[model samples]
Target: MASHLFVSSTRSFSCLSLILKPSPPLLGVKTLFSRSTRFPRTYKPLVRHGSNAHPKLLSALSSAPPVVAWKSSELSSARDDVVILGIETSCDDTAAAVVRGNGEILSQMVSSQADLLSRYGGVAPKMAEEAHSLVIDEVVQRALDNANLSGNDLSAVAVTIGPGLSLCLRVGVQKARKLAGRFNLPIVNVHHMEAHALVARLIERDLQFPFLALLISGGHNLLILAHELGHYLQLGTTIDDAIGEAYDKTARWLGLDMGKGGGPALEELALEGDANSINFSIPMRQHKDCNFSYAGLKTQVRVVMESKNISIENNPISSANSEDRRLRADIAASFQRVAVLHLEERCQRAIDWAIKIEPSIKHMVVSGGVASNKHVRARLRHVVETNDLQLICPPPSLCTDNGVMIAWTGIEHFLSGRFDPPPPADEPDDAMFELRPRWPLGEEYPKGKSEARSVKRARVHPSLTSMIQGSFQQQL
Candidate 1:
């Protein structure tokens, strides 16, 4: 059942930098904006409205600043580039991309799932997986065609490994392995969440680590430090439904279509919302580990709807004229405000830790579909300024589930010499070609606290510990 929808579901080469200088090498790291100089005016002034308490934004995230900085170095203009291929199937979309390591996208394609689940309301994993099974081959063909390259033209293949629906993941992984086996293509098992962290590099190559990365998507809400390339230390994770899930469920309750979903639609409505009109307090105000809980917020939304006797799953939110639009906007605004606050609170702790070593992390990159929210963008920008952390989010297209991110991640794995013996594409067809419900991007890379595995697998490589520093050194 899953493999059937899997076909419908949609869904990297990287540069390898060989170190020339041994010790604390001085690469002319590009200058990154400390924060957006001007406020993004996409949303009307909500803070100026009648509200007693301020959002408190990132006040606590700014303890140590970047004043104590890296030893400066003189550098040269760079021209060398990497070409990579990325494939994403962490959930319902079949996507693929070709990106230049220099931060330019050559080609990207997504076969969406909105039409498949429109009647059903919400996604059924089995149906989604089946969709993947049916359409993935064509999707890959389309991506490769769009890139003006065949599979043989790819340096490596990057496939999302986990932090997703197991059924959907299988179709992508299985296809990736088939390609790797047939082409002897180096395969990098990519982490859906980590890919969110690394895309910032494709855009802001000089982005420093020991900085906070908020990966808010359908399956996860992680607070992490990209201490180095390939390495990610999870400081905090979601204790409940992910921020994306909250947005999706809420969208469903509001009768938004599967095509629009929650995140994108909500963002559109929020433009007309009065964030202060709907009073929802921040959740997990008391948790200490930087861990987040979005389930409570989801429940709260449900409760509010129930109390108002508003229909969910059937009766979508109906705002017809300007007045109704205002109500939709208000709901969206309040929800966005709540989500942003939750992230801001947890990220504060992560930033505090980064400052202990680097003084200030140069960029506070927020990725994932929800990061595309204009209000979230606005709130986060303000937070970055208040805490002295630079706010960076990939362009909305890159922020969502796309092939460019996958291809870029694959390139990173390739440069790091991480390869796995993938399942042969020409092998006898059987369960071997079938999807596995389990795949881990970093599980085998390291164990316990600090131990990393030396042996390699077909999936995610590039020692995750690299996140602790810039393992992705600039040779430019």
Candidate 2:
């Protein structure tokens, strides 16, 4: 069975019946004037229904003695030059970036927890949260400074809200909310996996809707058919541990350097060893579906380690004898070969499935942390090319978690008028946030839906349920 975690869902658009005098319109601008009790008689009106109002307008309303009417040209300009600041703290990295609507990445900053991962062998959520807290402010500030802009200059503040560690995600979300509130900017809540998929669009301007995407990362392996922005049909997902998790475990067991995370270290080590040295079996050979499973392959490596008496406790890579090191490298080579073969096989099948449903799909986007692997990219590129489809892989920098993707995805949603209103600047620190640590990107295709749907649906947070349901209200 597959699972999902959501970040932001549709905000309620319920009509409020207010009995008040009508205000004069300017340039066909329709304003919904409302008094903020917390900020006193200041008419802080959000142009929810205005022909000239730009959805991405930044600090359009002032909280002073009187409300100012924005000119139509100003709103049009806002639409043309939407600037967004995106913050991401989904796991072990604290990342931020500033991007313009035209796909210009002004600045990007990432504070990686490499040392922590090296010491702890993996990310400890609470510890990761602390690390994010320590560097998040600096990272965001540096991104803004490098971009040569201030918070008020941004049209909206975007942040990854879910499909990550709750503790770690809070650091970024809280920062975004605070910044948005302080600057009176709209908030664009983003999904982590969605950002990974959509960031390819930022780089490839010609990419269009109804495409195929393979999102592979530390915690997820998903095959989705993107019908359009915010509309997707899930083709497949991991049935067990993700490929990145398997790589990390394999790297640790092999006593390989984990300073840069396991996937890259393993990929580097595989370069020296022969790929055909080990006879490890590929996973799920009998399963014709697109879903993935790495647990069995991981177990196979464990058995090999036990038989070879390669104990990590006694032999770190630095102290290992030449022969033992060679053996480890061979294992790395073999493991990566089969692991990627699994991805290749699933992608081929997913393409067949996706093409049947959406014949217009001409591209396959491969992205995420694992997608940064050169071997993975080359192998998948071959698969895509053979199917007569273009392969759209973001450069390695964009493949990994970063703020640019979030900002770009935010811009997509904002243009569609899908965003939340500005949060109150004085909101209490203890206020609850709308976080989705396990939100699904989209519904499973009926033909692919598993019996686990009920179980997965039951685990969703009530607030997330309302938002997700509201988001797909059109589908309903």
Score every model by TM-score. Answer: 0.73, 0.83
Best by TM-score: 2
Q: Give the TM-score of candidate 1.
A: 0.73
- Name the regions of candidate 1 deviating beyond 4 angstroms: 1-82, 101-104, 318-329, 421-425, 431-476
C-alpha local distance difference test of each model: 0.62, 0.77
- For every candidate in turn, the CA RMSD to the true structure comes to 14.9, 9.1
Ten-residue region with minimum lDDT total, candidate 1: 36-45
Q: Write the per-residue lDDT of candidate 1 for residues 91-171, one digit (tens) a residue.
A: 878787776544567677777777665656656788888888888887887676665666555546788876577788888
Model 1, residue 214: distance off in Å is: 0.8
* Residue ranges of candidate 2 with Cα displaced over 4 Å: 1-79, 450-458, 461-476
Q: Give the per-residue lDDT of model 2 (tens digit) for 33-86.
A: 111111101233443324433543434432212333546566445545566889
